[model samples]
Structures are given as structure tokens and as C-alpha cells.
Target: MKGVLRFGKVVKLSPRYIGPFEIVERIGKVAYILALPATYIVHNVFHVSSLRKFISKDPSKIITEDVNLQSDLTYVEELDRILEFSVKQLKSRDIPFVKVL
Candidate 1:
């Protein structure tokens, strides 16, 4: 899942559970069939160890936004605005950090 998640410059943070896809049925004692998005070209069936049941606490928190995926399964996050810019002095150099809003 190296290219599974990408957030701006941060690309090493990979999620344990990718989605809360609907379970179509049980394939076997250790396997299950899931209804994944069409954007995913991988197999829908997965092992039970790789699945996690999702329970929504707030129904209004449902995500209805569309995710624009590239051919390589990468999505670009648009930067709204730069809130603040600062520089931190390290041992031998200054590191610049920008806060975006």
C-alpha cells in the first residue's frame, strides 16, 4: 500500500483500513466479498484479517464529495491558502515551514 495514500508532501502515512466498503457476502471462513468503488481495479474479495467493520457515529458526517483519482490511483489535494510562514533554526541550518489554511 505504498502508493495507496498521499497527502501533499506526506506519502509514508498509510492507513490500516482503506475503506468501509459494503460486504457483499462471505466467500469462506477466512474470506469475504466486498463492494468496492469502481475506481479500484483490484479484486473485491479479501481476507477477513484485512477487513474492518465501520460504524458511523454521526450520520450527518457522511462524506458525499467525489474523489478525483489519477490513473496511478493518486489524488491531488488543492492548497487553499497559506495561513502562516515561519523559519526554525536547527543545529546548522534554518528550516522553513508553512501553515496552510
Candidate 2:
């Protein structure tokens, strides 16, 4: 589902999709009732635009990486290694820089 409700949290930090929940029933042409978890303190009925079709998961196509995110949804990026180092010749001084991966 599209992340519309923030639930008092930061909207940008919240997940885009909460679940691929089972559809309980169709309310009308553009609304549906989902079988949401008991922990979710919100209405079960949602507009069709807010819902997305669940595609079957493919293990071979999945890519996983170890990422440690902070409380504000930020992560510290560490440089693997410096690829190249160069010094630019200026009129009075030389500026040094390094290219990293």
C-alpha cells in the first residue's frame, strides 16, 4: 500500500508499503477491506489506489545488504578504499584529491 498515513511518525521515514495483506472483501469498485494484523490500530478498509498487487517473491532476484540505519533513518557510509590520488597544480599551491569506491 502507498504510505499515506504517518501514525504520528515522520511520513518520509515511514515505510512505503506496510503489508501485502489478504483481501477480506471488496467494499465497492474502488475500495477493499483487508485482513490486517490486530496490532495495526487503523481502519481496515482502504482505497484501491492505496493498495498494490503482490507479486510472488523470487529468491534468485533478491539482493540483500547489511545496512545499519540510525533512529532518523540515516546510515554512516564507509569508504572501501581509495581508487586513485591526484594533485592538481595551481598557481601558488597544489590541491590534493582522492577518488574512492
Candidate 3:
């Protein structure tokens, strides 16, 4: 996929699918052009693997959430916890490595 990586900071906390973005058109076989907001400077074309279809079980329903999208279209993420720690072997000695959630 030629598309760039987004939500680097909030990769863990952010929801995987943020939209039912309108599909402008289909590009080739597995690619699509979406009508994303102007804040998203990245290319609109995305591969099929990166896209998810939105389905509504009820005809009349509204979903709401407290999502904050920054000027760059990136959302905020919260830290979960520190899972574990390990020792890293160096040339001179070993050092402590911390893993966070």
C-alpha cells in the first residue's frame, strides 16, 4: 500500500475504523478514492485491505462518541499500562528495557 501511516501516537487507543467516508471512485481493482476531509493532506487513494465497509443494522440510529480530531486529523491516545520488562544485552553489560501500554 502506498498510503502513509497515520495515528502513530494513538495506535493503541484509537479505534481502527473512524469513518464511513464516501467513496469517490474505485481505482484499478483493489484501490479506492475516498472523499476525506481537507485536513487530511495525505493522498485519498487507499488499498482495499486498508478500507472497511460500514453497515447499519437499524435504519434509523445515531452513534456518538467524544473523539477529538486535531488539525492534522490525528486523535489523542491514552497510555494503558506497563506490561513487562526485560534485559537487553549490550557489548559491555546488560541494560533494563521497559515496555509500556
Candidate 4:
């Protein structure tokens, strides 16, 4: 229940049992990771509930605003569309393999 996940150091939270998520990229001290495109962490996101603020006054906040959901959807859709279009183009051109535009 307690261990360290490191970009370079250790962060100790009771890491919600909700990830075999993959880290796609990392820059600086932060990581960009992805999970199976669903909302899993249904609660306990805000460590700022009234009781928490009462118990510990460190009321810092970061809001992500569904950026991941939007980005993943866009990425998947764009990739699919690109592949389909490439297939059509290749079929029309009768090209055996992709050549420079």
C-alpha cells in the first residue's frame, strides 16, 4: 500500500488501485500517461474535501478539465481517419507501397 513512483524522486500516495496505465511521454518532473479510455477514479480526486482541509490545511489544486479524454479521442479518431484515407489513396493510385506524396 506504500511505495515510491519516481520520475526522479519518490511520491507517496495510497495510489488508487486503478492503473496499469502506460506512460506515453515524460518531460521534466511530470509524466503523460494513458489508461483504457474510461473514468475509473470515480471519487477521491479532490484531496480538498472539507474534512481534508480541516485535517490538513494544504489546499493546493490542479484542474485537468477532461483534457485527456478529449485528446485521446482526437488522437484515435485522427489516426483511424488517416489510415482509411491512405488506403483509399493507395488503392486509387495502385501504389504497392507509400511513396513520397
Query: Model 3, range 1-101, lDDT digits (tens) per residue?
Result: 23545533445564557667779999899999988776655578888997887788984564634456676667666669979989999999999988888
lDDT of 2: 0.68
Point out where model 4 deviates above 4 Å. Answer: 1-15, 40-101
**Candidate 2 vs. true structure, TM-score:** 0.48
Q: Pull out the clashing pairs in model 4.
A: none
Residue pairs whose backbone atoms clash in candidate 1: none
Regions more than 4 Å wrong, model 1: 1-11, 58-61
Q: What would the TM-scores of all predictions be?
A: 0.65, 0.48, 0.52, 0.20
lDDT of 3: 0.72
Which candidate comes out best when scored by TM-score? 1
Candidate 4 lDDT over residue span 1-101, tens digit each? 13432121233442223223334444345333343335433222222111111223443543233322222222111222222223334544753433342
Clashes of each: 0, 0, 0, 0
RMSD over all Cα atoms, model 1: 4.2
Question: Against the unseen true structure, what C-alpha lDDT does each candidate score?
Answer: 0.68, 0.68, 0.72, 0.30
User: So what's the TM-score on candidate 1?
Assistant: 0.65
**Candidate 3 TM-score, true structure as reference:** 0.52
